[model samples]
Target: MNKLRIGAATAAVLLALGTAAWSLRASGAGHTDASAPAPSVLTVEVIVPQQQSWPQSVQASGSITPWQEIIVSPETGGLRIAELLVDVGAVVKRGQLLARLADDSLQADLRKQQAAVAQAQANLYQAMSNLQRARMVDGSGALSAQKMEEYRIAEATSRASLDSARADLDSTRLKLSQTRIVAVDDGVVSSKSGVLGNVVAAGTELYRLVRQGKVEWRPELDARQVSTVHTGQSARLTLPGGEQVAGQVRLVAPTLSATTGRATVYVSLPAGAARAGMFANGTIELGAQPALTLPQSAIVMRDGRAYVYLVGSGSQVTSRAVSTGRRHGDRIEVLSGVDASARVVASGGAFLSDGARVTVASVGSAS
Candidate 1:
């Protein structure tokens, strides 16, 4: 009986010891599995920066206008419009007759004035003869002293009357010449405000002329940009159809616009290249600038911030913040946060994280 009880107790103790050992081993293995690091393996593209020559330029936009617009009006009034010699869009030379007023009245007035001039000349001749005779008779007492002085006064009065008639004739002739409305300069007629047989008043606008057929681009830019631009700077403008036209800066505004807080830059385009009222966008080349740039595909933006994936040894990548500048083509200028020699993930930055391990499956071509 004693031996049987001792054997049973020994068996129970041995079984308890085995069970505790198995539990301890299982718990230790679970802890070791839970604490182990996860594997981070990814395929990525890498890039090495290469310095290249690049041009620096600024963008601008504005409307095209005539180099000079002139207002054409008539000098004389109270006459009917008789003839419109040229129409809108007509090329005209200086002093070319654009329109004619009813000259019948003017011609009649001119003829009447000519007759008056002839009568004035006849009177002047008569006055001269009388003055000569008065001089010959003066102091000779051909008549009393009072009579001689009266003849001299009469001769002076006649001469003054003849001069007044001649002045009236000259005035009438000038009015006749003004009956024809002519161009003041060589230009293309842009607008016309004339009606045949309709009476027009003096100084009534007849036509609007674009002087010399030259067009200019007037680009509005911020004051800071205006300071860098100068006359003679070359620029290229893009038209509505994407046609690029070259132009040269002709003038820079001396003062900024008070309302818009911008300055105007006048760029002259090639003749017949553009017309007034054309809106265009352009870039002013500021010359070449040395820059450290990377492929545009390498940049990543998150939470309204710019980032880049920098690749280090062992294919480990770090998410780095970067400040970027101008963008040229597919590449962007890196102002800071990455050195020239830093290798970066060319693309697929969105899948990258800080301290992530990666492998260069394919390397991007050098830019």
Candidate 2:
């Protein structure tokens, strides 16, 4: 009976061991299947390039100034300022009276000149009569030759004196006419340096005139940028209040400033609107060129280098180092690295690794 029990126990032990081995094998297989990486599911954005027209533009800043400026000064000296006709900020026409010198002394001098002229005329008439009388007497032999010669000499002297006096009178009259100050151009008076009752010297600046109510914007551009700007290019002016005025590039300096590496760009504003010394900003368009562009978010920086992930055949991710150009709005220009026909990942590119399989969630449309 003991041998029978031991045999039954041995048989039971073997059967239990076999069942445990089978169960362990099944669980190992299940774990192995669960650990095996299913194809990495990656979310990506794909972009296909399309050919389109793009414009290249350059931007710069500048200020506004008067197109022309003139300083009005006195032409003659030693005149007391009698009346000021125009004040600062006053609009004036060409040849309009701006001021007047004290004319009391000038008027007296003018009268003196007129009297001198009348006296010269009377003297000339007397000389003519004396010459005629002397000739008649000499012809009739009633007067000696020496006496006729003396009378002729006296008449010639009187005639020369009369001509000299007339010339002096005309000069004085011209000087008298210059005492009134007049505007040299059609403009506004920007400054006034003289006042009534003040004595001024010749050529002293009495008023400042800004011509034609126009202004010039002189923008400094770098030497490289100077070549892009040209005369007659369209320009727009921005003021402090965001007001914009249309203008045109009128002049470009041929030389560059050595100190600043810049050249002057001149723009002309319309009349009766822009004033001198007003601050202004402007922009000018250079020509256009072909370029490949991508959104700023599409570029990825890795290990101190700029790169972008490209989608290959079957949505495989590949990183490519790229050279970029200027930024246009939210997009940047691609100078090199990616070809036009390739699909580029636009978003979620940083999470991608080389040769990683990806599934594109959205395809970007070309602009």
Candidate 3:
């Protein structure tokens, strides 16, 4: 009876142990089902390249210069500059007095000329009276024919002397007018070389003027670029001080430079827009044409080449290398490599890799 009782107890213990082991296994399975992770899907935005009319342009760099520089010089020689009126950067009008030469000697010569003119007039009047009197007495036998002929000859001589004196007076007046130096055109004085009390020679440069105060940008371009540029095209430039200026193509060089193999394009800027001798970088607008372009944010640079991310089947992003061209605003031209049908990741491409699956938040919106 003791052995049977012990065997029954053992069987009951084994059953209890088996039941507890099964319960523990069930709890572990439930915990595992609750804690297992889901697969990751990166949220992103995608865009489709569109065909839009974008301006065609060429990048150019060159210098700002005067459209027409006028060298101001004195026409008369051997005169001292008595007064300096206009200086550098002075705005002047046509025929405005720029400087005055020492005119004390000229004034004296003018007074002497006036006296000679008066004397000439008196002599001419006397000659005319004598001639009239000689004609009246002719053939009246009041005077001999020889004496009448002599009087006529004297009158002619006096008339010639008066004419010569008058000519001298007119020449003196012209010299006096030259003492006052005047501007040849309306312009802004760019430089001044004349000084007060300095003697000047004929054709001596006194000042430099920017004709009409006009300036132009001369951009050097290669042969291929020069071929496309035409008069009347629009241009936009950035000045040295970061100022923006607008200009229009005035002329294209007729010939290319033999040394540099480049051509100069003249772009006329508005007055006060820029100054001569300023270095500028600018672009010439050729015109507009349809182009396949994507937002600049869609582009990525990798391994020194431009690339874009294209969303493929299964929402997977693939890296695509692209050839880019002109950029306008936030959009960049896709010269080749990608087409309009490809869906590109607008932004956050730096965070992604090839074959990466993404959950697109919105179309045509940046991440």
Candidate 4:
């Protein structure tokens, strides 16, 4: 009976030990699975804030236009256009012939005037000869006083006719020269309204030119913002196709727009493939400023508010609201609400929430 009791107690003890070992193994497995971070939670790119010298700029949108658009018109009327020498978008120099008119009728009038001048000269010679004979014979009564006076009048009348004919000839020559329409300044032809065989009138617009191939960026800004811009300030423009153009502020409008109450800012750009009437948005750099900035992709705009995710211990991310200012390209300046040393999820902040767990794929600084 004593042996049976001892064996039974030993078996019970062994069974208890086996159960405890099994529970320990199970607990270890459960702890390992619970502690391990899931692979599919979320991955994000992280960045640290950097100190940079960023340019202070004014932002606006406007059209690229000509510095000066000169309208070329006809000075002489009633002539058919015989030739077109330039087309739209053609580059031309000052005094370049842009078009020519038919000169057949003009030449005919010139010839007629020349013939009249010749006839007047011949008449003047005859009258002068008569006047001389009358004066010589006046000593005798053969030439009366009335006849000499008439000879004097005839000489004067012929001389007057000769002067008038010469004046007419000069007028005809001037008219003939006007048959050619020339450029008044070096420019690019922006528009051409005249056609071959079409008769144009005086004061009729034939071509519109962009004088000197110079372009300007005219941005309309509010009155408060316009005061910040001035001549000689440098600017940069970005086209829709992602091309960048540099320019300088040339003028600030003295008056405000009546409808929009916005002031105009004119920025002159260098000669290039930039065309007038191109719509572009750009910034006029006021100067460089010390700032803490981050990549634009790092900011998450929600409900009209901008937010960023700050990295915490154990790959946790916290939502942080930041004040942004002076944005350029893909980088944005942080005005406040973030520390310079804080590591932020540069991108994929939209996929994260406050205290969200994440795995960082890359770490860098966006200055």
- Could you say which candidate leads in TM-score? 2
Write candidate 1's Cα lDDT for 229-305 as tens digits. Answer: 98888899999888999999999999998999999999999878888888999998777888888888889999987
- Write down the lDDT of every candidate, Cα atoms only: 0.86, 0.81, 0.88, 0.89
Alpha-carbon lDDT of model 2:
0.81
TM-score per model over all chains = 0.79, 0.81, 0.77, 0.65
How accurate locally is residue 281 in candidate 4, as Cα lDDT from 0 to 100? 93
Rank candidates, TM-score, best first: 2, 1, 3, 4
Query: Candidates 2 and 4: which is better by lDDT?
Result: 4
Candidate 3 error regions (>4 Å): 1-41, 126-160, 348-357, 360-362, 365-367
lDDT of 3 by residue, 235-323 (tens): 99999999999999999999999999999999999999999999999999999999888888889988899999988877888999999
Backbone clashes (count) for model 2: 1
Instruction: Kindly report which residue stretches of model 1 are placed more than 4 angstroms away from their true locations once superposed.
Output: 1-53, 144-151, 347-352, 356-365
Number of residue pairs clashing in candidate 3, backbone atoms closer than 3 angstroms, sequence gap of 3 or more or interchain: 0
